[model samples]
Target: MTEAAGKSYDGLPGAFRFAFSRSNSWLFKLYVAVALVLAGLVTIIFVFALIVLIADTVDASDGSISLLRSFFVLVGLLVVLPILAPVLFVARRHRREIGDDTGYDRRLASTGFLFIFAVYLGLVVSTPPEQQTSVDGALGPVLEVLYGLPSIVGLVPPVVAVLVIYGTHRLSR
Candidate 1:
């Protein structure tokens, strides 16, 4: 019985690893594509926010920055540096894969991007707007803009991602 079962299993295909799967379903591709783009955007946003925070603190400092300000900057830098590693790794891998002759996995790229975006979004949404606005001077204005032009701001990422993906696909061909 065991021998027969093993033979039957061997004849079947391998298990589906979520990130590594090569299935060409449109829904899966869409999900992944959105995810990849989101990840990149989130990372960029995070780095930008950190820079803005540090800059604001420095500007406000009159040659006597508070210990709290210094500590916050130090902590933000430490956090941002580590977060950058995965983003850089994914980017480098994507570049190499695209340049290679063996064709790259769009799905995998999408999955990675989506994962990063989800994490970033989760963190942002979890934080109260009041706290975020207090920490970053730009947040208040940015939020106002987003609120004022919800339709435009909401569509930007998806539209840009589609154009980028389409351009890359065209170039690769």
Candidate 2:
């Protein structure tokens, strides 16, 4: 098989290669990576602000200027649009190329698993002990380990849903 074909095997490295193949320059890849991170952070902030605003509205907070400030932050998320467009364009092109690769499914499965595992590990480790679940079970030490899992484990299914959407980008065609 060609080197490119060999790179399409079932793994995160392969997925990285496949996703980044369109751009040969490391600099450009770094640029895209930074842009994606920034966009993701801004989107997260916008969502947080929206949730806070919603909570305030539900509470019927005394008429104040703070609500207007939160609305402005929500609107400010639009400033990231210029950075988002080209990043999306690159992703769309990569999605289109998935059809040409015989190993796409395998790569997607493996990469999705690894990504989820890594993210969960990070979340669990970073979460404070107070935030984790505690359960008494029959497994002794094994149960001790399991009991330390955070409530954020509830987020795994949604994360998997996102991975499905990302990995099956070609479905949009």
Candidate 3:
């Protein structure tokens, strides 16, 4: 049997080499870092909002609060806290690897933006309509603002991702 040799791109054109080197630059890494951070923050915020919604639902139920409900909430936190953090971390790391190898920052940015948008959309769709109604006093607007925020804020993550990518590209050169 013949031994296999490692693959080489040594004979590739200068443009291909330059493209590969540029993708591996510190600037590209910075872009990936910022994208990952923004994606993480958006995910965390959405999860927190979801937790709060669940807690509020339990508290507002007409029946006496039961240990079962509290237990479920606790279980939810236990499951989600551990699972989500690492998943986000691993996902970001994977994205970094893809970006580094392929120079696919725009595609990564788009995917991250879509993920953030979907989370916000889910939050908005799941929220109770009653929660959106106006109330008297200073708390009314605040509650409304809080509940209405997901829809309004959904546009932000993608925009920020694009800006970060663009800014890093410009700064790197």
My TM-score estimates for the predictions, one after another, are 0.29, 0.35, 0.30
Kindly give the stretch of ten consecutive residues in candidate 2 with the minimal lDDT sum. Answer: 101-110
What tens-digit string does per-residue lDDT give for candidate 2 at 125-162?
44676675554666455535544556566356435544
Candidate 1 pairs with clashing backbones? 32-110, 35-113, 35-114, 36-113, 36-114
- Candidate models: Cα lDDT each: 0.43, 0.50, 0.44
lDDT value for model 3: 0.44
RMSD of 2: 13.7
lDDT of 3 at 58: 62
Candidate 3 residue-pair clash tally: 0
lDDT of 1 by residue, 38-146 (tens): 4356557666866776777875755565665566666454333332332232233333333322233443345334444544444444444455543358677655554
Per-residue lDDT for 30-116 in model 3, tens only?
434544455456457656766776677764755544555566556444333322332232233333342343334344433444444
> lDDT of candidate 1?
0.43
Candidate maximizing lDDT: 2
**Sliding window of 10 residues with minimal summed lDDT for model 3:** 1-10
Better candidate by TM-score, 1 or 3 = 3
